[model samples]
Target: MGVTGIGGLFFRADDPEALKAWYAQYLGVAPDGWTPWEQQAGPTIFEPFARSSDYFPAERQHMINFRVTGLDAMLERFRTAGIEVVTKAEWDSPEIGRFARIHDPEGNPIELWEPA
Candidate 1:
């Protein structure tokens, strides 16, 4: 059979355990290899941005995007938890979705998409 979906993401972190815990507590991801996170049926975008693109930080080579349901409420919770969330009006559209940006402790960029 052909590829079904994304299996897992492997990346380097300063403190793997701490990063894993951060994702687990903040983003509610199961970083443990034994427990796989379930995702709904939806579209998965796999476009590559230009090298000089300013969509995210230039120092970082890659960024991860996560699809969300309630953008406003989730952002509010993130704010209450003292996590910084960046949103721009231009990043939202009636056809596409709302978006917010956040960086990990190591300055890796992450984009949150609440699709329309």
Candidate 2:
């Protein structure tokens, strides 16, 4: 057989429950421990950022990028839910579409990208 799409993204969380709730509430991501969210069907982009990349400016070491649809609507949802969404002018490119940043309860940086 051939390789399939991404199955899951796992990471350490100081409070898994709270973190899961944050994702589910603000990002509309389902909470399934160790199980991948069956993301809405669409195009996906996967790439690694260089260590020197300033895309995510947290003191931590890693960031996760979530490919998403309806970027504007989602950003509004996060704001209505009292979550702060960060945007940068440089992060937007004519070829790459728009991007917004948010953090989980445990301070994990999440990049939400809407593809071009």
Q: Which candidate wins on lDDT?
A: 1
* Per-residue lDDT of model 2, residues 68-114, tens digit only: 88999988988887778999888999998899998887778888988
TM-score of each: 0.92, 0.79
Error of 1 at 78 (Å): 1.4
TM match of model 1 to true structure: 0.92
The residue ranges of model 1 lying beyond 4 angstroms of the native Cα positions read none
lDDT of 2: 0.80
Off by over 4 Å in 2: 34-36, 41-43
